[model samples]
Each structure stands twice: as C-alpha cells, then as structure tokens.
Target: MLVSRCKFTGISAPFSVGAFVKHLAVPLSTRLHCALVNAEGGPQSRAVHCPKFQALKSHQKEQLHLYVDALLEWNQRMNLTAVREVGEVMERHVEDSLSIVPPIRDSYLSRCGASCGKISVVDVGSGAGLPGLVLAIAEPDWQVTLVESMRKRCVFLEHAVNLAGVSNVEVVNGRVEDIGNDSCFREHFDVAVARAVAEMRVLAEYCLPLVRVGGLFVAAKGHNPEDEVKNAETAIRSMGASLLQVCPVESHGPYGQRTAIICLKGHPTPRKYPRSPGTPAKEPL
Candidate 1:
C-alpha cells in the first residue's frame, strides 16, 4: 500500500516523471575506488525492485552507477550528504531528486500548447548538485545553472559535472538571493527547483523571483506539505504566483514520502523580493 497522496487537493494519481540506474565496482577516474571498496562496508548496492532504477534505460543506469561512486568517494573527505549507505544513496539521493522531473517536463515543456523548446533552469541551493546535476544529465537540451553559496560544495559540483560529462550545466558559486536579483539571471529562467532549501513561505521568496512570468518553480518537499503550503499562500500571492499542484511522489523504498510543490509565476515578482541575505529564513515572508 505505498501511495503518493496529494492531500487537500483534488488528485488521485501518484506523482511521477518521464522514464529515466545500477551497482558496480568502484568506478574509474576518481582514484579512490579502493577506498570506497572498504568504506561503508562495501560499494553501495542497488535493488532491482526499486521503481526509479527500473525506469532508467540501461545507459542511464550505468551513468548513475558512476555518479554514485564519485559521491561516495568525495563524501568521505568532505561533508556531502548524511545518507552514507549505498542503498540509501540509491533511494534517498538519486531517486528522491529524480522525482521532480515529471512535473518539470509536464509544466514547462508543454506550457505552450505542446511545443517544446530549450529551457533555462536554475537550481537554488544546489549542494552536492543533487537534482541540478541529475537534471542536466537527464535533460540534455535544458540548460541548468546550479547556485550554491559555499565554495567547497561548488568545487565538488564542478568536479562532478566534469566527471559526469554533462556539458549543459554551470555551477554558480553565490547566494540565491544575490543571483535572483542580478539582471543577468533574474526573471530569466523557464523553471526553478529547490530541495530541502528552506520553509515553504521563505522558499517562495528565494525561488519565485528567479522565474520568468508564466514559468514554474518546483519545490521538492517532504511528507507534510499542507501546513507549509497554507502558510505560504500569502507569500505566493504577494510574489505574483499561484499554486499549480501538490504532487505526492511514490518513494517506495528508503526514499520515503515526497512531494513536488509546483508554483506558477503568473506575473513578475516584485523587484524587492528575496529580501536581504538571511531575512527570509529569520522572518518568513
């Protein structure tokens, strides 16, 4: 009875994305294969029954295998993620991030009567490049800009992007608030994504300003999103946006329950949005 529930919304279907993994010996090029071999008791393994891994094409599974190896290797030296187990990485890190893709494609690509075009996407607070780098790998035509305030994480992201051979991604080392206001990036994206970034109300302030009018902001959230969504109503409205849908994702394994809180940028966000550096978090909306 694994169910992706969109409570308080009139939806019966589970949230899913376009068909988009594998286990292997320590992958090449990182020079730490041996270390990963012994660390965490062994290489992170995958379950064939996992929904996300099964949907991936064989080639994609291979690429994910390599990416996981790199993540495990780098995580030992620097703090990347709290989920250190191989199986956990497969579910929580890889699959949890991939869940946002379905809504992204459905909302952004098909926004104009079924016509598709190159899309500019910004991944706010892209620590360790979870869904951002993942999205870049999954969608070649979509240009992805990963924004992170910490230099160390950005360094890791650069390395991962290069090793993954994804040419469409750029790692921008800066705060989202600053980047959101910059003329070069502000209101220029077709879509924006944030995961575990901040509370819903504060998150709206951080991400909505980056999307162009008629664009989307997809927030990868956890199980209890109703209250957050209720609280963020004012911020969403004031920021010239509206809730498109709350898509509950079926994370059948260790990934647990997830939600994609989709917001439509109906009009331009007020120029003063996103407030100062830490204002949104300290005092929401």
Candidate 2:
C-alpha cells in the first residue's frame, strides 16, 4: 500500500498504487489535492493550480493522463524526474509544460499574422519530454521533434509517445550540438525551446542554430533570471538572435516564480556556432 500525506494540511491517507492510478481521472480539485504526496513518504508538496490543465479538452486530458502514467511507471526503472507522485508530475511537469503554450502561440500569431498554419518546433535536451511531448499533445497541428542524447531516455520518449498515441512527435537520439550543425535540422524549425537544459549562454548555442531567421527560441528559466539574461547577452548576439522579452510564467513550486526568455532570430547563425560537441558548455560565447 502507498501512503499519501499533504504537506500543507498535514493530512495522511493510504491507498494501493492501482487505486492511485485510477484516481487520476478524478476531478481536477481532488487530483490536485492528492498530488501533494511526497515521494519520500513525508508530507506532500503544496497544491498547485493549473489553469492550463483545466483548459485541456477531454481527449487531450486523456492523452496527458496516459503519458503521465507511462512517465511514473518508467521512472521507477530509471531516473527521470525528482517528483515521483502522479499529482506532482501533473502539477510540476504537465502543467509547467502547458504554461508555455500560450506564449509560443501568441508570439507566433502576433508576428506571423495569425494564419494558423503548421509550425515546426524542436525541443532541445528533452529529458522526459517536458514541453516537447506535452506541446505535441496540446497542439496536434504542430510538428514537434524531441532531441535527447541518451538512448534510454529516447526509448522512454518513444514508449510514452506510443502509449499516448500522439503521431506528431519524432524522437531523435543525438546530441543537440551535432543536430545544430546537421543540414537536415539546422535552421529548419519555426521555434526552438529548452527547459532545465543549461545556462542561458550555453543553452542559446544549442537552440538558436536550429531556428530559422524569423523564428523564435524560448528558454524555460527559473524566477529571477535577470542576471542570467544579462550574462547571456553576448552569446545571444553572437548567435544572431536578439533578446526579445523575458516573460514571467507560473511558479513551479516554492521556487517563487518561473520565466520564459524569448529570443528572436534575426539572421542566420554563423557556421562556427554550436562549436563541436561538448564545446559549448566547456567554453560558452
């Protein structure tokens, strides 16, 4: 039997794993409350409000649930996320991923005239498919590519995609640095995004090369990332991108606030960029 304890309310309850899985389909309020269970059997985390998850359609919700189920099951075999409980996954990962949808969509629409055509997006360092898989699930018309270097994570991504039955996602098993230089991937996407991948400077090199001149590169960052944004200014300029805006997003937890740093690709990236595999992190611009 598994026991769940609420950190804020100090409430405890015991239930089987099977029962917990079944409770995933319960109403948002109940599920959100139940998600506070801590993985260490201690008090659960505080409840999070996910307006984005609340906005999902029934079928979309079903797909997300399936993906979360696979994530929790696979996590037991390998390290995926620190938050193991289902509700926490929904709050921290699913809803956190969903938070970027509006910014990406609105940014594209505001710049591209709202034609609503198919947009190509690439997710760099997509460990466990945070925004990549979640984005594909939310926007069916968009083509999303999940780039993960680890073969094991790639396998898990494929399995989760298959289980969710989402056909718009493609899992690639390779380093982002190499992919950035590949003709097939370089400058081929409408937008590129990364979350918890690296610092802003190093992350800019990995993602900007994959975006076309008129495209966007969004980095999911923690709250109070002004210093990081300032430090990465040189790197951002070197990558042919200009700092567009730093948009505030929903808080992930006690982390205060989260933000999305949006950069506009104005010119083609220099061939020298992404500098050899493992080079970017070793010596950033």
Point to the candidate with the largest lDDT: 2
The sequence of per-residue lDDT tens digits that candidate 1 reaches over residues 84-166 is 76667767767777777787888776663433357888898888787887777777788998887765666567667766676
Candidate 1 backbone collisions, by pair: 17-102, 20-56, 21-61, 44-86
- List ranges where model 2 is wrong by over 4 Å: 1-49, 113-117, 251-254, 276-285
Q: Which residue pairs does candidate 2 place in steric collision?
A: 36-44
Write down the worst ten-residue block by lDDT for model 1. 15-24
Candidate 2 accuracy as TM-score: 0.79
Candidate 1, lDDT over the whole model: 0.71
Evaluated against the true structure, the overall lDDT of model 2 is 0.75
Tell me how far the alpha carbon of residue 61 in candidate 1 is from the true structure, in angstroms, after superposition: 2.5
Candidate 1 residue spans exceeding 4 A from truth: 1-43, 47-49, 109-117, 276-285
TM-score of 1: 0.80
